[model samples]
Target chain A: MTQPIRVLLAKVGLDGHDRGVKVVARTLRDAGMDVIYSGLHRTPEEVVTAAIQEDVDVLGVSLLSGVQLTVFPKIFQLLASKGADDMIVVAGGVMPDEDVVEIKRMGVREVLLQDTPPDEIVQTLTRLVAERGER
Target chain B: MSRYVPSSELVERAARGEVPAIGRLISRAEAGMPEARGALATIYRRAGRAHVIGLTGVPGSGKSTLVAALTARLRTQGLKVGIVAVDPSSPYSGGAILGDRIRMSDLVNDPGVYIRSMATRGAMGGLARATLDAVDILDLGGFDTIIIETVGVGQDEVEIAKASHTTVVVSAPGLGDEIQAIKAGMLEIADIHVVSKCDRSDANRTLVDIKQMLTLGAATSAKPEWQTPVVGVSSYTGEGFDALTRAIDRHRDVAFGTASGSRRQLAIARFRLEKTAENLLIERFAKAAVTRAPALAERLRRRDADPYSLANELLAASFERGSAHERDHHRPPHFAEDHW
Candidate 1:
């Protein structure tokens, strides 16, 4: 039986605005992955646990509260400690170009800036997640 | 490691009001087993005690903030509250997206309030089946009111409203257009309509739009005689929590009624048993289907047999299992009846 690719979309830290996140959620749902959104204000641990239980292939976090430095590192470390390093972690939100580049070095697959179109993020993620399945 | 499964043990402890043990017990019970079933039965009796209030709105409608305020007001009234915050399940990651901590900051330190965020788990209509189960767990844990905060808009809100005594639909000003779009649609599910972020100038227009929709809908749709009350409040400024709480309180008692709430208890009991039975049957069906379908499908695909004959064989097999279940399940009762 063929299962739809599963993506865990989360909003982390003090940023509680979920308009962009929900729109992305609708977009992803239309794109045909079994999208599970953690909704708003998720911490790294909860996101990791949900990924494990939901058996997701990619963990995507969209943060707009300017707390990327605190959240991204924590998610990466938690995933590693939980032996979830194999699961791809993607970050998006209001990060500077330099911060996005720096996050990529720290084990995040992509840094999605707010300037990035919703479809662009979806397409990038769809390609990355689809590749993970091929392996 | 002995595969140290404490779930069974934890479930037993939780039923007895050992507060610390409830979470682990709920996890194990959700996993489902004989022990979990027994634990659920004992704990489920305490369920119908709470009034179920459903809070739902659009994305960015500030639902979480509103609920946090509702929790505060309920606490002041010396009421124990159970909140089941429904989160969307992601397609790629297949997990809960909204984190538990940040959404419900106020309740983190409060022992009186228990907040559990649930992913729809790929289920349509927003709230998951497990959400009902978790509500019972908290009800048994002893809450006076249980609030279900839904993840998104549309049909899911209506479904949850059917389950709750009072369904509070939250929305804001700028969302006036979208709220109007769904007015004759899903927003009609509300027992009370709340317009949050009332401080904004547009809030009044949004409230007026909702009222007009309500008025138009009331003519055609014979809703309960009481108009679905509309209130404007800003969760940020701590406004209107009191009225929302009062309305929630009054609506619950009247809807649940004079049997001293025996009917709601029966409803929840029915909900629990129905769910438990469905869960068991589904598990059995899946296991059997997984093991046997490939060969059946392969033969069908090869055109060695027609679909009609294939279905007949499958039906016969299912009938055999049905008879076996009836025989085993009814034998003890049959013998007792015969003896009588």
Candidate 2:
């Protein structure tokens, strides 16, 4: 039998605001996926390490502290350096449209803004996981 | 035919202490994939070598931090550790956001430690059966110590006390009196009562309260063979770890040193057997009962028949059918097909 999708939800950088990530955690959980949430103030290295160690199918980083440009790429580089580039990485929390586009260009599977509904986040994650699993 | 059969390659890799292979095996177990049973069957022979320690307490009780600290300490002593953190699943989605991994990030890069998060997945016990299976896999994979940190819901959490050889129930300061740790019935199951975040001013009072409760409780009414130690620990500062480890070692020596230790082992074995049998029996019979006696449920719902007698009647019918099938070589297609 195929394993259920496992996603790691992390807050990267100085993002002490975690209310959004908590909601996403609950939403994904309600959607019947296994989610591992690494709490706030995590460096990119810490996030990548946890994602690989946990063997998660996807990594969703929430960054409300406005460092997505630097954090997301560093995370991608770390995932590459650790030979975990195959892990699907997504971004959420507060990011401007232009920065979201730039971060997406940096190998984020998807960028979910703060306005994205919880259900939509779940749907996006489900789709991303399924798409990745097929590969 | 076997429901699921683990690949020999995967089993071999896990047995050789390959991290990814062990992670895959644990994932299969958590998902209740049929082949997981076969994998566990293979691993079970090599398990029972590691000490299983269970940690439980209320939310925000510093369980994850303590686990990290303990893993660090154990590693310093040249012991390999495995951690299984059980998280509560959402009632609506049957999914869980397991956050325990976040606290132990420092150990993620260490080859001496392995951490996996598990969702309850609607299991009757506080922990999903998969959690136990994962622990066994970790044990067989060469972890000297396995810690099963549980999500601390009230009554359901009692199962952890039974599942582990040593149950450490953690509490912190400022939970208030009416909702104190004692009121949660945690004291009954605690082999070691850990007061975490000892840096708080109220920490001393919480320790005092725990000591007072232990003294007053029935667990200490008589001159007990071993006294339960309430140790204060601050996971942040790493204070009191020596005392905590000593307490754990002392308890382990006395518990495993005596005849009662063996008795406790027997009890755990019995629990495992019963739980597995009960789950299998329910899977086989519950569906069969619904199909054969659809009206039985309706009648009971209408209060025409009481649950006690109805349960007895169902059990009798189920047993008779089961025995007849076994003895006479008769089979019910639907009965055998419908299993969770």
Highest lDDT: which candidate?
A: 2
Q: Write the per-residue lDDT of candidate 1 for residues B255-284, one digit (tens) a residue.
A: 677452455446645755665566554544
Runs in model 1 deviating more than 4 A are A1-135, B1-12, B15-17, B219-225, B258-277, B299-340
Candidate number with greatest DockQ: 2
In the range B1-340, model 2's lDDT, one tens digit per residue, is 0122244556787778876667767776665555456667778876888888989888888999999998888888898999998888777767777878878888877888988888787775568768888888888888988999988666446888777888898888888774463444787788888999998988999899888888777544432666778999999889988988887777676557777677777877887878767765665465558555677778899999998988777766565644433343223223353332
Looking at model 1, residue B29 earns an lDDT score of: 43
**Any runs in candidate 2 off by more than 4 Å, and if so which?**
A1-4, A13-20, A63-86, A93-117, A131-135, B1-7, B179-184, B217-225, B255-257, B285-340
How high is each candidate's TM-score? Answer: 0.63, 0.80
Comparing only chain B with the true structure, the TM-scores of all models are 0.80, 0.84
Cα-based lDDT at residue B174, candidate 2 = 87
Q: After superposition, how far is residue B159 of candidate 2 from its true place, in Å?
A: 1.6
